[model samples]
Target: MTSAALSFRYVGDSGMDETMNQQLLIDNGLPNSLAPVLSFKALDETHHVLPDVKVSTVFGSDRGNLVVPYGGSYDILRFSGPGKHDVTDVRVTVQRKTEARNPAGSHDVTTQALDSHGRAIEKFERFSAVRLINEDNFPVFVRIAYILWDQPPKGVTQQAVEVTPIGGLTSVPAHGTAVVKVSGKAAAAVARNSYGPAVSIKAYNSQ
Candidate 1:
Protein backbone atom coordinates (compact mmCIF):
# COMPACT_ATOMS: atom_id res chain seq x y z
CA MET A 1 0.00 0.00 0.00
CA THR A 2 1.13 3.59 -0.70
CA SER A 3 0.03 6.69 1.25
CA ALA A 4 0.10 10.19 -0.14
CA ALA A 5 0.03 12.32 3.06
CA LEU A 6 -0.95 11.66 6.70
CA SER A 7 -1.84 13.60 9.91
CA PHE A 8 -2.46 12.88 13.56
CA ARG A 9 -5.70 11.87 15.39
CA TYR A 10 -6.35 11.75 19.13
CA VAL A 11 -9.05 9.39 20.40
CA GLY A 12 -9.78 10.35 24.05
CA ASP A 13 -9.49 14.02 24.85
CA SER A 14 -12.47 15.49 26.73
CA GLY A 15 -13.64 19.07 26.06
CA MET A 16 -11.18 19.13 23.16
CA ASP A 17 -11.36 18.05 19.54
CA GLU A 18 -10.11 14.58 18.71
CA THR A 19 -7.53 15.81 16.17
CA MET A 20 -4.43 17.48 17.61
CA ASN A 21 -3.12 20.78 16.30
CA GLN A 22 -0.10 20.63 13.92
CA GLN A 23 1.81 22.83 11.50
CA LEU A 24 2.41 20.52 8.59
CA LEU A 25 5.19 21.18 5.99
CA ILE A 26 5.42 18.14 3.80
CA ASP A 27 7.27 17.21 0.55
CA ASN A 28 8.44 20.77 0.06
CA GLY A 29 12.12 21.69 0.00
CA LEU A 30 13.38 18.92 2.25
CA PRO A 31 16.25 16.44 1.88
CA ASN A 32 15.95 12.69 1.58
CA SER A 33 18.17 10.37 3.67
CA LEU A 34 17.60 7.39 1.40
CA ALA A 35 19.83 8.89 -1.27
CA PRO A 36 22.70 6.55 -0.52
CA VAL A 37 25.48 7.27 2.03
CA LEU A 38 27.86 8.89 -0.48
CA SER A 39 25.07 11.04 -1.94
CA PHE A 40 23.00 12.00 1.12
CA LYS A 41 23.80 15.54 2.28
CA ALA A 42 25.35 16.05 5.66
CA LEU A 43 23.40 17.92 8.37
CA ASP A 44 26.11 20.56 8.65
CA GLU A 45 29.84 21.00 8.73
CA THR A 46 29.87 21.35 12.54
CA HIS A 47 27.07 18.94 13.46
CA HIS A 48 27.49 15.18 13.36
CA VAL A 49 25.27 12.14 14.11
CA LEU A 50 26.12 8.94 15.99
CA PRO A 51 25.40 5.40 14.95
CA ASP A 52 22.96 3.03 16.78
CA VAL A 53 21.83 5.37 19.55
CA LYS A 54 18.27 5.83 20.82
CA VAL A 55 16.59 8.95 22.24
CA SER A 56 13.46 8.78 24.33
CA THR A 57 10.40 11.06 23.96
CA VAL A 58 8.63 9.77 27.07
CA PHE A 59 5.48 9.37 24.94
CA GLY A 60 2.33 8.16 26.66
CA SER A 61 1.86 5.19 24.32
CA ASP A 62 3.21 1.75 23.53
CA ARG A 63 4.81 2.88 20.27
CA GLY A 64 6.82 5.42 22.28
CA ASN A 65 8.38 8.13 20.04
CA LEU A 66 6.54 6.93 16.98
CA VAL A 67 3.12 8.05 18.22
CA VAL A 68 2.30 9.95 15.06
CA PRO A 69 2.18 7.36 12.24
CA TYR A 70 2.20 4.19 14.28
CA GLY A 71 -0.06 5.50 17.07
CA GLY A 72 -0.44 2.44 19.33
CA SER A 73 -0.90 -0.35 16.85
CA TYR A 74 2.43 -1.57 15.36
CA ASP A 75 5.87 -0.67 14.12
CA ILE A 76 7.29 -0.44 10.53
CA LEU A 77 5.26 0.37 7.40
CA ARG A 78 5.42 -2.80 5.31
CA PHE A 79 6.14 -1.57 1.79
CA SER A 80 6.17 -3.38 -1.57
CA GLY A 81 7.57 -2.29 -5.00
CA PRO A 82 8.02 1.27 -6.39
CA GLY A 83 11.38 2.93 -6.97
CA LYS A 84 13.10 5.89 -5.23
CA HIS A 85 11.64 8.58 -7.49
CA ASP A 86 8.03 8.04 -6.29
CA VAL A 87 8.58 9.01 -2.65
CA THR A 88 7.68 12.12 -0.64
CA ASP A 89 10.31 13.29 1.82
CA VAL A 90 10.11 16.04 4.46
CA ARG A 91 11.25 17.20 7.88
CA VAL A 92 9.16 17.18 11.09
CA THR A 93 9.62 20.60 12.71
CA VAL A 94 9.03 20.14 16.45
CA GLN A 95 8.26 23.43 18.20
CA ARG A 96 8.80 23.50 21.94
CA LYS A 97 6.97 25.96 24.21
CA THR A 98 9.22 28.00 26.45
CA GLU A 99 6.77 29.67 28.82
CA ALA A 100 9.35 31.25 31.13
CA ARG A 101 11.46 33.06 28.57
CA ASN A 102 9.54 33.38 25.31
CA PRO A 103 6.04 32.97 26.79
CA ALA A 104 4.98 31.84 23.32
CA GLY A 105 7.04 28.60 23.64
CA SER A 106 10.15 26.92 22.27
CA HIS A 107 10.69 23.60 20.47
CA ASP A 108 13.43 20.97 20.46
CA VAL A 109 13.05 18.99 17.25
CA THR A 110 15.41 17.02 15.08
CA THR A 111 16.82 17.66 11.63
CA GLN A 112 15.73 14.31 10.22
CA ALA A 113 13.83 13.28 7.11
CA LEU A 114 10.35 11.66 7.15
CA ASP A 115 9.35 9.51 4.17
CA SER A 116 5.67 9.61 3.22
CA HIS A 117 5.63 6.68 0.84
CA GLY A 118 4.79 4.36 3.76
CA ARG A 119 8.17 2.62 3.76
CA ALA A 120 11.30 2.75 5.89
CA ILE A 121 14.51 3.75 4.15
CA GLU A 122 17.16 1.56 5.73
CA LYS A 123 15.99 2.63 9.24
CA PHE A 124 17.66 6.01 8.66
CA GLU A 125 14.58 7.33 6.87
CA ARG A 126 11.16 7.44 8.52
CA PHE A 127 7.89 6.39 6.87
CA SER A 128 5.62 5.41 9.77
CA ALA A 129 7.19 7.59 12.48
CA VAL A 130 7.73 11.19 13.55
CA ARG A 131 10.27 11.20 16.37
CA LEU A 132 10.08 14.05 18.92
CA ILE A 133 12.50 14.90 21.72
CA ASN A 134 11.52 17.36 24.49
CA GLU A 135 14.26 18.47 26.92
CA ASP A 136 12.03 20.74 28.98
CA ASN A 137 10.44 20.63 32.41
CA PHE A 138 6.84 21.09 31.27
CA PRO A 139 5.27 18.97 28.58
CA VAL A 140 5.23 20.16 24.95
CA PHE A 141 2.15 20.73 22.84
CA VAL A 142 3.13 18.82 19.67
CA ARG A 143 2.12 20.30 16.33
CA ILE A 144 3.92 18.18 13.79
CA ALA A 145 3.61 18.69 10.04
CA TYR A 146 1.88 15.26 9.49
CA ILE A 147 1.66 11.55 10.08
CA LEU A 148 2.60 8.49 7.96
CA TRP A 149 0.74 5.52 9.34
CA ASP A 150 1.47 1.80 9.27
CA GLN A 151 -2.17 1.04 8.41
CA PRO A 152 -5.00 3.28 7.19
CA PRO A 153 -6.56 5.09 10.17
CA LYS A 154 -10.32 4.71 10.73
CA GLY A 155 -12.94 7.28 11.92
CA VAL A 156 -10.83 10.27 10.88
CA THR A 157 -11.67 13.36 8.85
CA GLN A 158 -10.41 11.60 5.66
CA GLN A 159 -10.53 14.77 3.53
CA ALA A 160 -8.36 17.12 5.62
CA VAL A 161 -7.95 17.99 9.33
CA GLU A 162 -8.30 21.39 10.95
CA VAL A 163 -6.60 22.38 14.23
CA THR A 164 -7.69 24.95 16.77
CA PRO A 165 -5.50 27.96 17.45
CA ILE A 166 -3.93 28.08 20.87
CA GLY A 167 -5.12 31.34 22.42
CA GLY A 168 -2.78 32.11 25.38
CA LEU A 169 -1.68 28.56 26.20
CA THR A 170 -4.01 25.80 27.17
CA SER A 171 -3.69 23.34 30.00
CA VAL A 172 -4.15 20.55 27.51
CA PRO A 173 -0.87 19.60 25.80
CA ALA A 174 -0.01 17.29 22.90
CA HIS A 175 0.56 13.58 23.44
CA GLY A 176 3.90 12.56 24.96
CA THR A 177 6.38 9.66 24.87
CA ALA A 178 8.48 9.14 21.71
CA VAL A 179 11.71 7.24 21.16
CA VAL A 180 14.02 8.86 18.63
CA LYS A 181 16.82 6.91 17.01
CA VAL A 182 20.06 8.85 16.88
CA SER A 183 21.57 7.39 13.78
CA GLY A 184 22.77 8.32 10.31
CA LYS A 185 22.02 11.94 9.47
CA ALA A 186 19.74 12.36 12.51
CA ALA A 187 20.69 15.33 14.67
CA ALA A 188 18.97 17.71 17.12
CA ALA A 189 18.00 21.36 16.80
CA VAL A 190 15.78 23.95 18.52
CA ALA A 191 12.91 26.10 17.26
CA ARG A 192 10.89 28.79 18.97
CA ASN A 193 7.12 28.53 19.48
CA SER A 194 6.65 30.49 16.29
CA TYR A 195 4.55 27.68 14.86
CA GLY A 196 2.78 30.46 13.00
CA PRO A 197 -0.65 28.87 12.44
CA ALA A 198 -2.30 25.47 12.61
CA VAL A 199 -2.59 24.29 9.03
CA SER A 200 -5.06 21.83 7.54
CA ILE A 201 -3.74 18.28 7.03
CA LYS A 202 -5.17 16.64 3.92
CA ALA A 203 -5.42 12.91 4.46
CA TYR A 204 -3.36 10.78 2.07
CA ASN A 205 -4.92 7.94 0.16
CA SER A 206 -2.85 4.75 0.61
CA GLN A 207 -3.23 3.39 -2.93
Candidate 2:
Protein backbone atom coordinates (compact mmCIF):
# COMPACT_ATOMS: atom_id res chain seq x y z
CA MET A 1 0.00 0.00 0.00
CA THR A 2 1.06 3.53 -0.77
CA SER A 3 0.45 6.59 1.38
CA ALA A 4 1.07 10.32 1.00
CA ALA A 5 3.68 11.88 3.28
CA LEU A 6 4.25 15.46 4.39
CA SER A 7 7.12 17.24 2.62
CA PHE A 8 8.64 20.65 3.32
CA ARG A 9 10.88 22.96 1.34
CA TYR A 10 12.64 26.32 1.85
CA VAL A 11 10.43 29.22 0.80
CA GLY A 12 10.50 33.11 0.73
CA ASP A 13 13.33 35.35 2.08
CA SER A 14 15.68 34.86 5.07
CA GLY A 15 16.15 32.10 7.68
CA MET A 16 13.01 32.87 9.80
CA ASP A 17 10.86 33.76 6.75
CA GLU A 18 11.96 30.64 4.84
CA THR A 19 11.27 28.43 7.86
CA MET A 20 7.75 29.95 8.28
CA ASN A 21 6.99 29.57 4.53
CA GLN A 22 8.14 25.95 4.60
CA GLN A 23 5.97 25.28 7.66
CA LEU A 24 2.99 26.91 5.98
CA LEU A 25 3.38 24.83 2.83
CA ILE A 26 3.70 21.64 4.85
CA ASP A 27 0.67 22.49 7.03
CA ASN A 28 -1.49 23.11 3.95
CA GLY A 29 -0.92 19.47 2.83
CA LEU A 30 0.05 20.40 -0.72
CA PRO A 31 1.17 17.76 -3.23
CA ASN A 32 4.75 17.71 -4.45
CA SER A 33 5.50 18.06 -8.18
CA LEU A 34 8.21 15.37 -7.99
CA ALA A 35 6.30 12.12 -7.46
CA PRO A 36 7.02 8.50 -8.34
CA VAL A 37 6.07 7.32 -11.84
CA LEU A 38 4.41 4.06 -12.75
CA SER A 39 4.33 2.38 -16.19
CA PHE A 40 3.53 -0.95 -17.91
CA LYS A 41 4.04 -2.87 -21.16
CA ALA A 42 2.73 -5.89 -23.09
CA LEU A 43 4.44 -9.09 -21.83
CA ASP A 44 4.62 -10.95 -25.12
CA GLU A 45 3.51 -11.24 -28.76
CA THR A 46 -0.02 -12.45 -28.02
CA HIS A 47 -1.14 -9.63 -25.68
CA HIS A 48 0.59 -7.02 -27.84
CA VAL A 49 -1.34 -7.83 -31.02
CA LEU A 50 -4.77 -8.17 -29.46
CA PRO A 51 -7.22 -5.29 -29.81
CA ASP A 52 -9.44 -3.60 -27.23
CA VAL A 53 -12.23 -5.65 -25.61
CA LYS A 54 -15.95 -5.04 -26.16
CA VAL A 55 -19.20 -6.92 -25.37
CA SER A 56 -22.29 -7.87 -27.38
CA THR A 57 -25.86 -8.58 -26.30
CA VAL A 58 -26.87 -12.25 -25.86
CA PHE A 59 -28.85 -14.03 -28.58
CA GLY A 60 -30.41 -17.48 -29.05
CA SER A 61 -29.34 -20.43 -31.24
CA ASP A 62 -31.02 -23.52 -32.72
CA ARG A 63 -28.24 -25.98 -31.83
CA GLY A 64 -29.34 -28.79 -29.45
CA ASN A 65 -27.38 -31.04 -27.10
CA LEU A 66 -28.18 -34.54 -25.85
CA VAL A 67 -28.89 -35.26 -22.17
CA VAL A 68 -27.14 -38.25 -20.56
CA PRO A 69 -25.74 -39.12 -17.14
CA TYR A 70 -22.12 -38.50 -18.25
CA GLY A 71 -22.64 -37.04 -21.74
CA GLY A 72 -24.03 -33.69 -20.45
CA SER A 73 -27.04 -31.62 -21.57
CA TYR A 74 -25.19 -29.29 -23.95
CA ASP A 75 -24.20 -29.84 -27.59
CA ILE A 76 -21.77 -28.09 -29.90
CA LEU A 77 -23.07 -25.67 -32.53
CA ARG A 78 -20.49 -24.82 -35.17
CA PHE A 79 -20.33 -21.65 -37.31
CA SER A 80 -18.01 -21.66 -40.29
CA GLY A 81 -17.53 -18.97 -42.96
CA PRO A 82 -14.96 -17.11 -44.93
CA GLY A 83 -12.69 -15.06 -42.66
CA LYS A 84 -12.19 -12.62 -45.54
CA HIS A 85 -15.40 -10.76 -44.79
CA ASP A 86 -16.72 -9.22 -41.60
CA VAL A 87 -19.15 -11.77 -40.15
CA THR A 88 -22.52 -10.32 -39.09
CA ASP A 89 -26.27 -10.81 -39.48
CA VAL A 90 -26.76 -13.82 -37.15
CA ARG A 91 -30.25 -15.19 -36.39
CA VAL A 92 -30.97 -17.93 -33.79
CA THR A 93 -34.09 -19.98 -34.44
CA VAL A 94 -35.45 -22.59 -32.00
CA GLN A 95 -37.94 -25.02 -33.53
CA ARG A 96 -39.93 -27.51 -31.43
CA LYS A 97 -41.31 -30.75 -32.75
CA THR A 98 -44.78 -30.39 -34.28
CA GLU A 99 -47.00 -33.00 -32.69
CA ALA A 100 -49.91 -31.65 -34.74
CA ARG A 101 -51.75 -31.10 -31.37
CA ASN A 102 -50.28 -28.34 -29.09
CA PRO A 103 -49.41 -25.71 -31.73
CA ALA A 104 -48.83 -22.36 -30.06
CA GLY A 105 -48.29 -23.50 -26.47
CA SER A 106 -45.50 -25.98 -27.35
CA HIS A 107 -42.86 -23.54 -28.64
CA ASP A 108 -40.79 -20.77 -27.11
CA VAL A 109 -39.23 -18.87 -30.03
CA THR A 110 -37.90 -15.35 -29.44
CA THR A 111 -36.16 -12.97 -31.87
CA GLN A 112 -33.47 -10.28 -31.35
CA ALA A 113 -33.02 -8.85 -34.88
CA LEU A 114 -30.71 -6.13 -33.60
CA ASP A 115 -27.24 -6.40 -35.14
CA SER A 116 -24.28 -7.15 -32.87
CA HIS A 117 -22.28 -4.42 -34.64
CA GLY A 118 -24.86 -1.64 -34.43
CA ARG A 119 -22.53 1.22 -33.60
CA ALA A 120 -20.19 0.50 -36.51
CA ILE A 121 -23.10 0.62 -38.94
CA GLU A 122 -25.59 3.35 -38.18
CA LYS A 123 -29.35 3.60 -38.97
CA PHE A 124 -29.97 0.05 -37.66
CA GLU A 125 -30.00 -1.05 -41.28
CA ARG A 126 -27.30 -3.71 -40.77
CA PHE A 127 -28.59 -6.55 -38.57
CA SER A 128 -27.52 -10.18 -37.85
CA ALA A 129 -28.50 -13.02 -35.46
CA VAL A 130 -28.38 -16.85 -35.17
CA ARG A 131 -31.05 -19.57 -35.26
CA LEU A 132 -32.02 -22.16 -32.61
CA ILE A 133 -34.05 -25.36 -33.08
CA ASN A 134 -35.12 -28.01 -30.54
CA GLU A 135 -35.31 -31.38 -32.23
CA ASP A 136 -35.68 -33.89 -29.33
CA ASN A 137 -37.93 -31.65 -27.23
CA PHE A 138 -34.93 -30.85 -25.09
CA PRO A 139 -34.20 -27.15 -24.37
CA VAL A 140 -30.50 -26.46 -25.14
CA PHE A 141 -28.16 -23.99 -23.47
CA VAL A 142 -25.67 -22.57 -26.01
CA ARG A 143 -22.86 -20.14 -25.14
CA ILE A 144 -20.62 -18.97 -28.01
CA ALA A 145 -17.07 -17.62 -27.73
CA TYR A 146 -14.47 -16.59 -30.36
CA ILE A 147 -10.81 -15.83 -31.10
CA LEU A 148 -8.88 -14.29 -34.03
CA TRP A 149 -5.83 -15.89 -35.55
CA ASP A 150 -3.81 -14.05 -38.20
CA GLN A 151 -2.47 -17.23 -39.80
CA PRO A 152 -4.16 -20.15 -38.13
CA PRO A 153 -2.45 -23.50 -38.64
CA LYS A 154 -4.32 -26.28 -40.44
CA GLY A 155 -4.65 -28.60 -37.47
CA VAL A 156 -6.63 -29.36 -34.28
CA THR A 157 -6.19 -25.92 -32.69
CA GLN A 158 -7.25 -24.30 -35.94
CA GLN A 159 -10.70 -25.89 -35.70
CA ALA A 160 -10.88 -26.46 -31.93
CA VAL A 161 -14.11 -25.68 -30.04
CA GLU A 162 -14.68 -24.38 -26.53
CA VAL A 163 -17.59 -23.79 -24.15
CA THR A 164 -16.52 -20.18 -23.86
CA PRO A 165 -16.24 -17.68 -26.71
CA ILE A 166 -12.71 -17.91 -28.14
CA GLY A 167 -10.37 -15.51 -29.83
CA GLY A 168 -10.93 -11.72 -29.83
CA LEU A 169 -13.98 -10.95 -31.94
CA THR A 170 -13.98 -7.24 -31.16
CA SER A 171 -10.26 -7.11 -31.80
CA VAL A 172 -10.41 -9.44 -34.80
CA PRO A 173 -8.97 -7.45 -37.66
CA ALA A 174 -10.41 -7.34 -41.15
CA HIS A 175 -9.77 -10.58 -43.13
CA GLY A 176 -8.58 -12.35 -39.99
CA THR A 177 -9.87 -15.88 -39.32
CA ALA A 178 -11.67 -16.69 -36.06
CA VAL A 179 -13.04 -19.92 -34.56
CA VAL A 180 -16.16 -19.44 -32.38
CA LYS A 181 -17.88 -22.26 -30.43
CA VAL A 182 -20.82 -22.68 -28.01
CA SER A 183 -21.02 -24.79 -24.80
CA GLY A 184 -23.70 -24.97 -22.08
CA LYS A 185 -26.21 -27.26 -20.37
CA ALA A 186 -29.83 -27.91 -21.44
CA ALA A 187 -32.59 -29.89 -19.76
CA ALA A 188 -36.35 -29.70 -19.15
CA ALA A 189 -36.97 -29.55 -15.41
CA VAL A 190 -40.79 -30.02 -15.31
CA ALA A 191 -42.48 -32.48 -17.61
CA ARG A 192 -45.34 -30.03 -18.17
CA ASN A 193 -43.01 -27.06 -18.72
CA SER A 194 -43.88 -25.90 -22.28
CA TYR A 195 -41.07 -23.43 -22.91
CA GLY A 196 -38.53 -26.27 -22.65
CA PRO A 197 -35.34 -25.68 -20.66
CA ALA A 198 -34.68 -21.93 -20.75
CA VAL A 199 -31.24 -20.87 -21.98
CA SER A 200 -29.57 -17.48 -21.49
CA ILE A 201 -27.26 -15.75 -23.98
CA LYS A 202 -24.15 -13.99 -22.71
CA ALA A 203 -22.21 -11.90 -25.30
CA TYR A 204 -18.87 -10.20 -24.86
CA ASN A 205 -17.94 -7.20 -26.99
CA SER A 206 -14.29 -7.09 -28.10
CA GLN A 207 -13.54 -3.59 -29.21
Candidate 3:
Protein backbone atom coordinates (compact mmCIF):
# COMPACT_ATOMS: atom_id res chain seq x y z
CA MET A 1 0.00 0.00 0.00
CA THR A 2 2.61 2.53 -1.02
CA SER A 3 1.67 5.99 -2.41
CA ALA A 4 3.27 8.91 -4.30
CA ALA A 5 2.66 12.68 -4.13
CA LEU A 6 3.34 15.70 -6.41
CA SER A 7 3.36 19.49 -5.87
CA PHE A 8 3.91 22.58 -8.09
CA ARG A 9 4.23 26.41 -7.87
CA TYR A 10 4.28 29.38 -10.31
CA VAL A 11 4.71 33.18 -10.06
CA GLY A 12 4.74 36.06 -12.58
CA ASP A 13 2.62 38.70 -14.36
CA SER A 14 -1.11 38.55 -15.25
CA GLY A 15 -0.36 37.50 -18.85
CA MET A 16 1.14 34.25 -17.62
CA ASP A 17 -1.00 31.11 -17.41
CA GLU A 18 -1.07 29.23 -14.07
CA THR A 19 -2.41 25.86 -15.11
CA MET A 20 -0.87 22.41 -14.28
CA ASN A 21 -1.39 18.78 -15.30
CA GLN A 22 0.02 15.44 -14.00
CA GLN A 23 -0.51 11.65 -14.04
CA LEU A 24 -0.54 9.15 -11.14
CA LEU A 25 0.35 5.43 -11.11
CA ILE A 26 -0.17 2.94 -8.24
CA ASP A 27 2.09 -0.10 -8.06
CA ASN A 28 0.24 -3.28 -7.16
CA GLY A 29 3.01 -5.17 -5.38
CA LEU A 30 0.86 -5.84 -2.31
CA PRO A 31 -2.65 -7.24 -1.91
CA ASN A 32 -5.57 -5.87 -3.97
CA SER A 33 -7.74 -5.37 -0.85
CA LEU A 34 -6.15 -1.99 -0.15
CA ALA A 35 -7.99 1.07 -1.50
CA PRO A 36 -6.53 4.37 -2.72
CA VAL A 37 -8.01 7.89 -2.48
CA LEU A 38 -7.13 11.12 -4.32
CA SER A 39 -7.13 14.61 -2.79
CA PHE A 40 -5.64 18.02 -3.69
CA LYS A 41 -5.52 21.79 -3.09
CA ALA A 42 -5.32 24.70 -5.55
CA LEU A 43 -4.64 28.19 -4.14
CA ASP A 44 -4.80 31.73 -5.58
CA GLU A 45 -2.42 34.08 -3.71
CA THR A 46 -3.29 37.24 -5.61
CA HIS A 47 -6.83 37.35 -4.22
CA HIS A 48 -7.71 37.76 -0.53
CA VAL A 49 -10.99 37.62 1.45
CA LEU A 50 -9.76 38.86 4.81
CA PRO A 51 -8.83 42.48 5.67
CA ASP A 52 -11.07 43.62 2.79
CA VAL A 53 -9.11 43.41 -0.49
CA LYS A 54 -10.47 43.06 -4.03
CA VAL A 55 -8.92 41.05 -6.87
CA SER A 56 -7.52 43.22 -9.67
CA THR A 57 -5.73 42.60 -12.99
CA VAL A 58 -3.35 45.56 -12.88
CA PHE A 59 0.17 44.98 -11.54
CA GLY A 60 2.05 47.36 -9.20
CA SER A 61 0.70 50.66 -10.58
CA ASP A 62 -2.12 51.12 -8.05
CA ARG A 63 -0.10 50.12 -5.02
CA GLY A 64 3.03 52.04 -6.00
CA ASN A 65 4.81 48.66 -6.08
CA LEU A 66 5.75 45.83 -8.40
CA VAL A 67 2.82 43.39 -8.40
CA VAL A 68 3.45 39.74 -9.31
CA PRO A 69 0.89 36.93 -9.72
CA TYR A 70 1.63 33.62 -7.95
CA GLY A 71 0.03 30.38 -6.72
CA GLY A 72 0.43 26.54 -6.22
CA SER A 73 -1.12 23.10 -6.96
CA TYR A 74 -1.01 19.80 -5.01
CA ASP A 75 -2.40 16.28 -5.53
CA ILE A 76 -2.53 12.75 -4.09
CA LEU A 77 -3.61 9.41 -5.70
CA ARG A 78 -5.04 6.30 -4.08
CA PHE A 79 -6.04 2.83 -5.43
CA SER A 80 -5.86 -0.91 -4.75
CA GLY A 81 -2.80 -2.52 -6.30
CA PRO A 82 -1.14 -5.87 -6.92
CA GLY A 83 0.82 -4.45 -9.88
CA LYS A 84 2.63 -1.22 -10.73
CA HIS A 85 0.93 2.20 -10.73
CA ASP A 86 2.55 4.67 -13.11
CA VAL A 87 2.17 8.46 -12.76
CA THR A 88 3.62 10.42 -15.68
CA ASP A 89 3.21 13.16 -18.29
CA VAL A 90 3.36 15.97 -15.72
CA ARG A 91 3.56 19.57 -16.99
CA VAL A 92 3.63 23.02 -15.31
CA THR A 93 4.60 26.45 -16.70
CA VAL A 94 6.11 29.10 -14.39
CA GLN A 95 7.06 32.77 -14.84
CA ARG A 96 10.32 33.67 -16.56
CA LYS A 97 11.49 37.19 -17.38
CA THR A 98 12.47 37.46 -21.06
CA GLU A 99 13.26 41.17 -21.29
CA ALA A 100 15.70 43.48 -19.52
CA ARG A 101 15.38 46.35 -17.04
CA ASN A 102 17.70 48.88 -15.44
CA PRO A 103 16.60 48.05 -11.88
CA ALA A 104 15.42 44.46 -11.80
CA GLY A 105 14.30 42.56 -8.70
CA SER A 106 14.74 38.94 -7.59
CA HIS A 107 12.56 35.79 -7.61
CA ASP A 108 12.66 32.76 -5.31
CA VAL A 109 10.68 29.48 -5.17
CA THR A 110 10.77 26.46 -2.82
CA THR A 111 8.91 23.14 -2.26
CA GLN A 112 9.02 20.69 0.68
CA ALA A 113 7.02 18.08 2.66
CA LEU A 114 6.84 17.38 6.41
CA ASP A 115 5.52 14.61 8.62
CA SER A 116 3.39 14.84 11.79
CA HIS A 117 6.57 14.99 13.84
CA GLY A 118 7.59 18.16 11.96
CA ARG A 119 10.48 16.47 10.13
CA ALA A 120 11.14 17.33 6.50
CA ILE A 121 10.97 14.31 4.20
CA GLU A 122 11.46 16.14 0.89
CA LYS A 123 12.67 19.64 -0.15
CA PHE A 124 13.63 21.78 -3.23
CA GLU A 125 14.52 25.46 -3.67
CA ARG A 126 15.61 28.16 -6.26
CA PHE A 127 16.49 31.82 -5.69
CA SER A 128 17.51 34.93 -7.71
CA ALA A 129 17.68 38.56 -6.51
CA VAL A 130 19.30 41.79 -7.74
CA ARG A 131 19.67 45.44 -6.80
CA LEU A 132 20.22 48.45 -9.10
CA ILE A 133 19.76 51.38 -6.73
CA ASN A 134 19.93 52.37 -3.04
CA GLU A 135 16.14 52.64 -2.63
CA ASP A 136 14.34 49.76 -0.94
CA ASN A 137 12.28 47.62 -3.35
CA PHE A 138 9.45 45.36 -2.22
CA PRO A 139 8.90 42.41 -4.54
CA VAL A 140 5.66 40.39 -4.53
CA PHE A 141 5.94 37.04 -2.76
CA VAL A 142 3.76 33.85 -2.66
CA ARG A 143 4.01 30.36 -1.14
CA ILE A 144 1.86 27.19 -1.35
CA ALA A 145 2.02 24.01 0.78
CA TYR A 146 0.57 20.45 0.47
CA ILE A 147 0.07 17.41 2.75
CA LEU A 148 -0.40 13.71 1.70
CA TRP A 149 -2.50 10.93 3.23
CA ASP A 150 -2.47 7.11 2.90
CA GLN A 151 -5.54 5.09 3.96
CA PRO A 152 -5.28 1.38 4.65
CA PRO A 153 -7.79 -1.43 5.34
CA LYS A 154 -9.75 -1.71 8.58
CA GLY A 155 -8.02 -1.76 12.00
CA VAL A 156 -5.39 0.71 10.73
CA THR A 157 -4.75 4.16 12.22
CA GLN A 158 -4.49 7.28 10.04
CA GLN A 159 -1.08 8.97 10.14
CA ALA A 160 0.02 12.54 9.49
CA VAL A 161 1.55 12.90 6.05
CA GLU A 162 5.10 14.17 6.06
CA VAL A 163 4.92 17.05 3.82
CA THR A 164 8.07 18.10 3.26
CA PRO A 165 14.46 36.80 -0.02
CA ILE A 166 15.48 40.25 -0.92
CA GLY A 167 16.76 43.40 -2.36
CA GLY A 168 17.14 46.30 -4.57
CA LEU A 169 17.38 49.91 -5.61
CA THR A 170 18.40 52.16 -8.34
CA SER A 171 20.46 54.85 -10.08
CA VAL A 172 19.36 54.64 -13.77
CA PRO A 173 22.74 53.16 -14.74
CA ALA A 174 22.68 50.08 -17.01
CA HIS A 175 20.52 49.49 -20.09
CA GLY A 176 20.56 45.67 -20.08
CA THR A 177 17.96 43.23 -18.65
CA ALA A 178 17.90 40.55 -15.95
CA VAL A 179 15.99 37.32 -16.52
CA VAL A 180 14.73 34.74 -13.97
CA LYS A 181 13.13 31.34 -14.54
CA VAL A 182 12.05 28.46 -12.18
CA SER A 183 11.09 24.90 -13.09
CA GLY A 184 11.47 21.33 -11.73
CA LYS A 185 9.84 18.11 -10.50
CA ALA A 186 9.41 16.62 -7.00
CA ALA A 187 8.30 13.16 -5.78
CA ALA A 188 7.69 11.46 -2.39
CA ALA A 189 6.69 7.98 -1.22
CA VAL A 190 4.72 6.84 1.84
CA ALA A 191 4.10 3.40 3.29
CA ARG A 192 0.85 1.59 2.64
CA ASN A 193 -1.75 1.46 5.47
CA SER A 194 -0.82 5.00 6.52
CA TYR A 195 -3.51 7.70 6.52
CA GLY A 196 -2.76 11.42 6.25
CA PRO A 197 -5.08 13.99 4.62
CA ALA A 198 -3.48 16.62 2.34
CA VAL A 199 -3.45 20.39 3.13
CA SER A 200 -2.48 23.65 1.33
CA ILE A 201 -1.70 27.20 2.62
CA LYS A 202 -0.06 30.40 1.29
CA ALA A 203 1.12 34.01 1.97
CA TYR A 204 1.94 37.06 -0.22
CA ASN A 205 2.70 40.81 0.00
CA SER A 206 -0.61 42.73 0.01
CA GLN A 207 0.75 46.26 0.12
Give the TM-score of each candidate.
0.19, 0.18, 0.19
- The 0-to-1 C-alpha lDDT of every candidate, in the order given, reads 0.23, 0.21, 0.24
**Per-residue alpha-carbon lDDT of candidate 3 for residues 55-146, written as tens digits (9 for 90 to 100):** 11111212223222222112222222221112112222222221112222232223333444434443221121221221224332322222
lDDT of 1 by residue, 1-207 (tens): 112222222221122553432112112111211110001111112334222222111121112222221111111111123321121221222332111211111333332323455333322232333444444454533333232222224432121122111111112123343433222222221111113322221111010
Top-down lDDT ranking: 3, 1, 2
Off by over 4 Å in 1: 1-104, 111-126, 146-207
lDDT of residue 84 for candidate 1? 16
By summed lDDT, the worst window of 10 consecutive residues in model 1 runs over 32-41
Best by lDDT: 3
Q: What C-alpha lDDT does candidate 2 achieve relative to the native structure?
A: 0.21
